[model samples]
Structure formats: structure tokens, C-alpha cells
Target: MSRRFSPSNLFLGSLFVLAAFSFDQLTKTIIADIVMQPPRVIVITGFLNIILSYNEGVSFGLFSEILRGRPEILVFTSSVIVAGLLVWMSIAGGRLEAAGLGLMAGGASGNIFDRMERGKVTDFIDFHLAEWHWPAFNLADVAIVVGALILVSGSFLSPQQDVIGK
Candidate 1:
């Protein structure tokens, strides 16, 4: 069967992506508004907790300083780049890649929306060592990571199989 781009595929893929985005945004809003200060951690162990936080950074709190404090340049640049990626994913990236692209696009869009609306992305999940802590992350971060992993793994998996003595 030939794999071809189709409007139906794009629409379905976009729907999944948008659904993920909506869920992430909805969760963040609930945490931000309903959750109390220090955000009632649901302790799983010494290493993990669900505590509300605001992350003004690229993934894992990188470039947080750029996101925080400064308002114009970095935010605008990030927004534009992410928006471009979403457009590309919507228009291109056929069925196999659609889920991954949708995930990445939706996640980036969700986080960008958060930053634009609240000036920071709401983060809650946290893990730590005795003295060290991983950066707080949220649903969007999870989606991005999962999508990236899938894309990378798929790249490795979907190659031509070499055969000998046909």
C-alpha cells in the first residue's frame, strides 16, 4: 500500500494534538487557581512529589532567566518558532509521523499559551535526590519528551531490511 498524505489524516492527527494541548492547559489552570500555596504535594516517596510550580524556562528549567524577567525578545522568538513548527506539522508529516508531530506541536503550543497568558508555565511534578532536585515539569513537558522519544525510535525502526541470496 502506498503511504500518501491525506486531509482526513491531518484532521484526525490535529484533533489528537489539540486534545492533548487542551488537557495540559486545563490541568495547569486548575493547579494555578485551585491548588493552594506550596501546592499540596502528593508524596510518592522521598524522591517524588506533585507540587505546583511555575516554570519560566525551556525544558528542565534551561533558559529560565531569559523567559523570566525579560518579556519581549525571547518570548516572541520562542512563540514564533513554535508556531512555525505547528504549521509545518499540520501541513506535512504523514500518518506515521503524525502522532509524534501532533504531540510535539500541541505541547509546544500549550506551554506557549501558558507563558503568554500567565507569564510562566505551570509545573508540578518534581523529583529529587537527598540534596539535589530535578527541574519541575508538567503535562506539556511529558508530551514533548514522549513524542521526541517516539520520533527518534521510529527513525531507527522504519528502515529497509537488507536481505541476501534472494
Candidate 2:
């Protein structure tokens, strides 16, 4: 059966995205303006710390240095991607799918906002094991990753399996 793109679903998806975006932006703003100067770090363990890090790159400062020095490319790319996602979300169906896209949109929007306004994204949560340290990340990154996982997992469930006990 074909799925119809309903207004209520669109609204719900948009609302979720907006909520996520707001939370992400607010946290980043707080960290960038109030927390980064002193750079407060809460040691969760020997390998994890909640430390404020202003990253200009996409993830874990991978392209941050390059993006930090050249903001135009990053800005343009993010804008296009975000716009494309929005368009896709507008027509996407399935409850989980809509929710996932909303999360991705919101997370991307939040980081994009930071890149545009603050010239970097504020990353606070850090994890490391042995010599390998993951890039510092924030709520938005978590949301995006979690949402993507949910979407991927959901894709594996057939309609019959979703409707009945599998």
C-alpha cells in the first residue's frame, strides 16, 4: 500500500526537529560562551570527561581546522545538506522514519547554527579507551547517531513482523 504524506505527521516531524535543534543550540551556546573560557571538565572516569571543546570540523576535529580557517565551504555544504534533508522529511513516511529524520535534521541544524554563528560547534562529552580517544561530542551528535541507529534497525523489521510477534 502506498503511504500518504499527512499534514499532522509532517507537523509532528517538524516539531521534533525543532525541539532537538533548540536543545542542541542552547547547550552549545551555553558551553561556547560561559563554559569554554575556563573550559570546565568533569572527569567521568579515567577515560571519559565532560569537557567543553569548540570543534570547527565535522566530527572530532577531523576537518575542523580546515573548516575553521575556511568557513564558506562548510557553511554552503551544511546548508545544502540540511535543505535536502528537510525536503526528504517533508515527504517521508513511517513513524520511526519520520522521527529519525527529524532527529538528524535537528542535530544537523544545531551544529550548522554553531558553525555559522560561533564559527565552531561546542563538544563536551568525551570518551577514550587506552590510546584511542573519540572526538568530543554533544547532545546533537548523540541524537543523530541514535536516530540513525533506530532507523537502520527499523528497516530490518518487515510489516508482518512489526504487526505480529516475530
Candidate 3:
């Protein structure tokens, strides 16, 4: 009965969460099990390539030395973040904000799943310019970043409507 618990909001949140989560997991599976086997690089373009790598820590391999190969810590941290996002989405106004929260939750969940199943996150998307390169990342990371951007931008753009409207 409450506005925060409206069926429409729940539907939109569920739709985006399911979609993002499924896509993230599917892409990871395909990259890890099929495309990257034999551990060789696959070039997609001059600027893009696939070379599988495992991340034992958070974004950009930060805290890899701090975690020291303990996946449980990452799993717990990700679970907490995802839980917060889910609660935030429940009360968030508008489909745009809800979708953003949903995507964040889904992506976080996918990475948490990875930490649990493989003891690390599987990253395969590689971007480079000749000798210059960026750290490898996966689909879940993309979803989380874009979702956070959308959520933040939507809040600033719509203010009350995006965060607390009826």
C-alpha cells in the first residue's frame, strides 16, 4: 500500500536486476569457459582484446596485497553493498533511479558470485593503445559503473523526483 512498496516500482527493479544479472553472469561464463581457454589473447580490434585475468581484490586490483588472497572478505563486502543498494532501490522514486539501483545490485551480485565460486573475479575485456593498456575488467564492473553514474546523474537532474517523489 505504501508508495515505496508499489508494484510498478518493484516490477521495474526486478526487470532490470534480472536482466543485468543474467547478462553479467552469461558473459563471464562464456569468457572464462569458452573464449579464453588455453589462456591466449583474442584480439577484437586495435583498441580491444580479450586476455583473461583473475582479480583477487577490489576495483583495479586495489588491496590485492591487503586481502592476501582471501575471497571471503570481498564476498562479504560486496554482499553488504548489494544489500544497501536493494534497500535504497525499494524506496527510490522513478523507474530511472530504480533501474540504476537494480543494475548496481545485479552487477555487485554477479561479482560476489564470482568471488564465491572461483575465489576471484574473472576479468577478460582488455583495452589498449599500442603499448599503453588498461587493467582488464568484466561485464559486471561495467554495469556497476554505468549504473552508479546513472543513479548519480539522475539524482542531480531530477532532484526530488528521482529520489523522493510520489
* lDDT of every predicted structure (CA atoms): 0.70, 0.74, 0.83
lDDT string, candidate 1, 1-166, tens digits: 2345557546755875797799898888777677645558777799988788887777777788766765455468767876765565555434545566677777877887877777777898788998798988888888777767756665554323211111
Ordered list by lDDT, greatest first: 3, 2, 1
Pick the TM-score winner. 3
TM-score of each: 0.78, 0.84, 0.89
Q: How much is the lDDT of residue 35 in candidate 1?
A: 68
Greater TM-score among 1 and 3 belongs to: 3
For 60-157, candidate 3 gives per-residue lDDT tens digits of 89988888579999999889988888887777667778888888888889889989999999899999999898999988888898888888788676
The residue-level lDDT of candidate 2 at 78 comes to 78
1-166 per-residue lDDT for model 2 (tens digits): 1256656546766886898899988887776677666877778899987787778777667866566667667778878887876776666555566677788888888887777777777788889998787888998898788768867876886544332112
Stretches of candidate 2 above 4 Å error?
1-4, 35-37, 159-166
CA error at residue 113 for candidate 2, angstroms: 0.4
